[model samples]
Target: MELQVLVLRPIFFFFFFVFLTILQQSSSARVLTITKPDRHDYAASARWLVSQNSWGVLSTLSVDHKGAPFGNVVSFSDGLPEKGNGIPYFYLTTLDPTARNALKDQRASLAISESPLGTCTRDPMNPTCSKLTLTGKLLILEGGSEEAEVAKKALFTKHPEMMDWPKDHDFRFFKLEIIDIFLINWYGGAKPITVDEYLHAKSIKLASFL
Candidate 1:
């Protein structure tokens, strides 16, 4: 009886250890799964968010002594997405102080958002808000390059009134070369998208931006 009891005790301990190990692994996997975002869902939602709004806040660092951040509400013309390019690019004109500061500093961020249109009362049909944040470096196009010409033409097409501005004046065309992009859909419930995934899912042709 003593021999039998010792053998059973060792077997029980081994099974118990295996059970705990399996439980720990299961818990870890659950945590990882919860944290991971669904790339497909994020990509689709990000595209929708951009399509919903034509304007966004253009944020740039101040070039003055303060070196603070400044945001401006600007009207933007949307660019179509191309494969390997994340969300579409946008164009807007700015001669304001913010633009000048950004030109001197080159680092900037752009944000676009959309909220429930009518009353504060929440409706199931429109229970959520969305926003996209883009971090990139701004490059000022100078001289007579084909790219500059195309940017000018596209700008004019979006804003016909701009044509009335004097021709001799230096109208700087800025190309935002995106470095990192993030999209939060349904206020953080949906998955988030990184710049690489965005570019991979969409195709942005140069002609479209031009």
Candidate 2:
């Protein structure tokens, strides 16, 4: 009986370890399985970065700091998952310095990277990792308007918690009217993609990447 107990103990531990290893591999696979657009397709690549990401750094000229550039981490959405318009929408309040700075100086930019998407196998700073900066004016939409309604749906769908945020805090919808786009997806310098090329680029179908 003592011999049987000792033999069974090692067998039980071996099986348990195997189960844990399998589970860990499965989880990693799920995270690393994301498919990104080809780096050569500049417009599609830029749109992909914006669509896949839920947040980015929004930089505005600081009103308090005497026109110095101020960058803040902000949550944003282009549209529903796999459906994006290439325009970034944000939910913000005057209570936050970012919102206040935008109101004072509409000139701003939103920077997004592929690092958070888990598709980048290289260092985030590596050129192959891909990054984008959309320079434009940040404008607050009217409380009740056709465009504002669209913004609300686009935002709430991606970030459900925004729907429950404190109303009294006065969070309003804002959008970056992209005037210039800077993208780097490969070893070369910035891509020569025009604004029209980006906004009117073929909409990325989820099936294409999958």
Candidate 3:
């Protein structure tokens, strides 16, 4: 019985270490994929918010409503997954009032919340939940431009269905030329992240195993 027990113990210990190794790899994968930037790092936090979200409220001066503020839920991408450039790109058609509004007046702001990312446990209105509003000029890209080509790839990769949308709808690519950034990630008032900081800051480089 003692000889049998000794032989089984080594096998059990070996398997136990194998299990731990597998578990560690799994946890590391989760951290690399979903880890959010520290809230105090305002620029990184802002970029993370923009990159993680696929859609947000894009507000523009309404052309049909006598210049009133118009907010429309729109899909946008900053870049390919985990490799965003901190500039929001959109596929829009003039048939949509939001796109028509942008043509008349380029001033716009995109508001995104941490709620959709599922990282916020508290009420979305809570300051700790984090929110970003990028105010900028919305400009359309000329067809076949180099920047337009890049924007198309970013949009299509993040939103594959966009590639299949009706081409006759006059959908064009537009980007937000961000001027001001308002971010609330913690308790105090909005963080004072400048446009340059937000754009040039090192974004969180979380690797995606998926």
Best candidate, lDDT? 3
lDDT of 3 by residue, 49-97 (tens): 8888889999999988899999999999999866789999999998999
**How many backbone collisions does model 2 have?**
0
Predicted candidate 2 versus true structure: per-residue lDDT over 97-175, tens digit per residue: 9999988889999999999887789999999999999999999999899888888988998789999999899899999
List candidate 3 segments past 4 Å from native: 1-32
Clashes of each: 10, 0, 0
lDDT of 1 by residue, 1-210 (tens): 999899999999999999999998866432211122233466655544443344577788876647888887764443422221233233434556656876688887777764521112343333254456778876676647865666565555555676777655555666666787766555445355676666555432223331
Native RMSD of candidate 2 (Å): 3.6
User: Where is model 2 poorest over a 10-residue stretch in terms of lDDT?
Assistant: 26-35
Error of 2 at 135 (Å): 0.2
Off by over 4 Å in 1: 1-40, 80-94, 116-127, 187-190, 203-210
Q: Higher-TM-score candidate among 2 and 3?
A: 2
Clashing pairs in 1: 81-203, 82-202, 82-203, 82-204, 83-202, 83-203, 83-204, 84-199, 85-199, 86-199
**What lDDT does each candidate get?**
0.56, 0.89, 0.90
